[model samples]
Target chain A: MRSHQTVVDSRLRRRRTAETVFRFFLLASVILVSLILSIIVVSILWKSLPALKLSMIFKTPGTGYYLGKRGGILNAIVGSIEISFGATLIALMIALPIVIYLNTYLKKKSFLSEIIRLFLDVLWGIPSIVYGVFGFLLMLMCHLRASLLAGMLTIALVELPILSRAMDETIRLVPNELKEASYSLGATRWQTARHVVLRQALPGLITSTLIALGRGLGDGASVLFTAGYTDRITTSLLQPVATLPLAIFFQLNSPFPEVQQRAFASAAILTLLILFISLLTRFLGRKLSRHRIK
Target chain B: MDKGRVLKKEKGRLVAAGLISFFPIFLTIAIFLLLLIKAFPLLSLKSLPDLIFSSAWQPQKGQFGLWPFILGTIWVTATAFILAAPLSILTALYISDYASVRLKKWLAPVLDLLAGLPSVIYGMWGTLLIVPLVGKFLAPLFGTYSSGYSILTAGIVLAVMILPTIVNVSVEVLSAVPAELKEAALSLGATRFEVVRYVVLKKSLSGVAAACVLGLSRAFGETIAVLMVVGNVPVAPVSLFSPAYPLPALLANNYGEMLSIPGYESALNLAAIILLLIVIIFSLVARLYLARLSRRRDR
Candidate 1:
């Protein structure tokens, strides 16, 4: 009896040890991920602090900027805002309508909606470089040069699936009962979508737009070929535009230390902008959710 | 007359929505066809197998063998998956099962921030920190030398870039597992860990697999970050320490200056097509699998 009890005790001890080890690993992984995030933020900030200046945001890169001359990244900053904003606006116009149609006009889990969702999923997974290539081809076909218009079109394709899917999920969250109430009031489908669904999904729509904007703002590959970079600020949709991601890429690739330092500064600025947008998303999501009905 | 006007407006809105909804489908088809048409010239020059399997990549000399790049992409993506899959899965498990409410709230925004950061920033960070650490410390410890811009360095950076996707999806999947199932295991004298292991993980196995596949797809097509740190060598990588070039990098680097060369544009377009095909296939498979899994569960 004593031997059997000892055997049971040993088995229990083994199980207990296994559980402890497993939990330890789980905790370690969480800490490791958090540590990596902090490391990325801290290291970028550390390298960029010495080179970052207030004037960098206001002035355009002058001649000999790549040779370590004095200048700013205003051209890139302005161009990035223009291209991403243009893309987001274009994506929203299409995405909002499609999302509303899917959620309200069609039955839940209809075959057509399923197929559309599948296509969006695949589109979301396509690499930005592919879009760049496609955009280049489209430009050739249209006899258009590498310009801000081309960049906006390419980035719009990138943002479309993201915006549609995000809005689709959010619009799905609106209760059927709400739509039914609108219908009982003799409202048409469009009126119900505009008044009932759109009102309830306003916060989600804003959040989705912000997310797509962030994506477009940060993406470098899709614009690499389509948005030919220029030192001067873009004055027209037909002219080439500079962007922050390309600024970072070109600066880092330079053989000069000062140029590389500017690269770090550019990265810092982009990271901070994206970080602000992310936090704003969370804050806005919460503030807007107060108006949502459950 | 007012009611008639309202009806007419509704009809117009429906027609507009229907047409706009087809735009994405039309765009997808156009992209694929354009790539195929552009890539056709290269296929006429060389067989598909030769184009894909040949190791020589001198664009100036008219050779466009993509074997080295194909292998390089496979190596870096596999390394990233190996490094990230476990960490993300465990992180998801911890967040869902072990993290306190306060910790969960704090972690959400942190993960979102991580996810939102651009690839260029990740690449810059890798170049500044990871590249030197590998070139100086890890390589020497392993009795080798590297310039810190190697496949391993790229893999490490890419792994971190993809962490948020895997973890977020897995957490969603794990949280969806019935709480009652976990409680039942606990009531039957199983420890919390065992209950999670036997019940939660078992039930959510397909979902976790889908999350990993999604992460893999993201890692596969990531361009700028991988290009920045991946040494951009055209040779196939033999070891983790070797510099390599990936397909996206190849497409991005060669598009502008070399269009004057014969067949160069077509070759680059073919590379883009290959990337598109791979990413599309993987994501579709994962989505379909998840759909099937959920359908089964619902029944």
Candidate 2:
């Protein structure tokens, strides 16, 4: 009896201590990663702080031998925003409806959907640099050539899988009973999906779009190849343009330290934009859940 | 009832929506097709075995061998798998089965943040920190000239990159194994180690395999990090210390300048096409496995 009791007690103690240790390990990894992120952010900020003057932010980099004494990352910043937004808009326009279609008209098309899903996975798994090669081919081929359009198209392809899958997962999370209720009330398949299901899934869909946007912002290799870098404002959408990511890459490669400083600033800004998008999703997600709880 | 008009309108709209969806994906495919067609001219080669098994990859001279790059990709990816899988699975096991509820909640997001970081940042960190560290301690191990960039450098960086992917997916799959299954194992007087190795792992084996494969794919597609750390030596690697070039790194580094060379661009595209084929194969396999998992879950 005593031995049995002692065995059980030891087991309980072991379990308790084991749990504590496991949690500590997980906590440590998290803290370590978070700390690293902060350090990166801070280092970038520190390096680039001297150049964050309003003039520096607004004026473009110089063209001649005075490349280091630039005013701002004006063209690159604007171009990044334009290209990323352009790409996300094109992607969402295309993917959102398909996700809806898969949920509604194509619910029974599981075989086709399965194939498409697999291909999307393949697309996502491809490295960004390959897209650059494809972009060159697209430019070399014909009318739909290199420009912001090509860059956006390249990013659109990259973000498609992530956003569409996010859309599918989010759409699936909408309760079946809600769909059943809409259908029973004499709503068409499209009507129920557009009105009830979509309204309910709006938050998730928006969040997915933001995440895709954030991804587009950070992805460099593909963007650099697709959208050839330029210092000046090229109003023609057909011509190559620069994005912040490409700027970061170019600057990192440049021999000048000042160029490197600009890269850090651009990276810091990009990181901030990404984190903002992430925080917005979590905030909105939490608020929605809290409202539901209430 | 004016149901006929509504039906007509919706049918039209649905068609339009489907077309819109088709167009962007078609755009993605169009890019793929262009890449495919451009490279098709060069890919008509000697023998498939010679292309794959011959230890040379000097496609510039019309030699289509890929043994070195393929072997490098596999060896580095495998090394990453070896390093990351054990830690991630153990971490997942500890979290889902061993940790208390409150602790699990606290740790999940931390792991997620680690996973959420962009790959470029990993490249930056590896270049700045890992490369130097390797030169200090590990260059002597493989008889290198204290060049910090090597296969070993890549393996460590890639291991960090794949940890989140393995852990998150494994946690979900392991948790999905029926609670009753674990209880039954425990009721039979099985030790914690025995239950994990036998019951939980066996039931989750397929899903775990998917996670492992996905990790391999993730490590394989990694470009910027490997480019920064792998030393980009086109020469065949004789040791972990030897610099190597995966296909993605080769194309990324050489493509821009190679475009000026007549056949060089095509050669690069040939390499790109090869990478695409590998991706498609793994993707189909993983998707089939996932579909099976979902179907089993439904049952």
Q: Pick the candidate with the highest DockQ.
A: 1
Which residue ranges in model 1 land beyond 4 Å of their true spot? B297-299
Report residue B92 deviation for candidate 2 (angstroms): 2.1
Computed on C-alphas against the true complex, the DockQ of each candidate is 0.86, 0.37
For model 2, the DockQ equals 0.37
Q: In order, how many clashes per candidate? A: 0, 2
**Residue pairs in collision within model 1:** none
lDDT of each: 0.92, 0.73
Pull out the clashing pairs in model 2.
A56-A71, A56-A72
lDDT of 2 by residue, A262-292 (tens): 7677666666676677677677766665433
> How well does candidate 2 score on lDDT at residue A163?
90
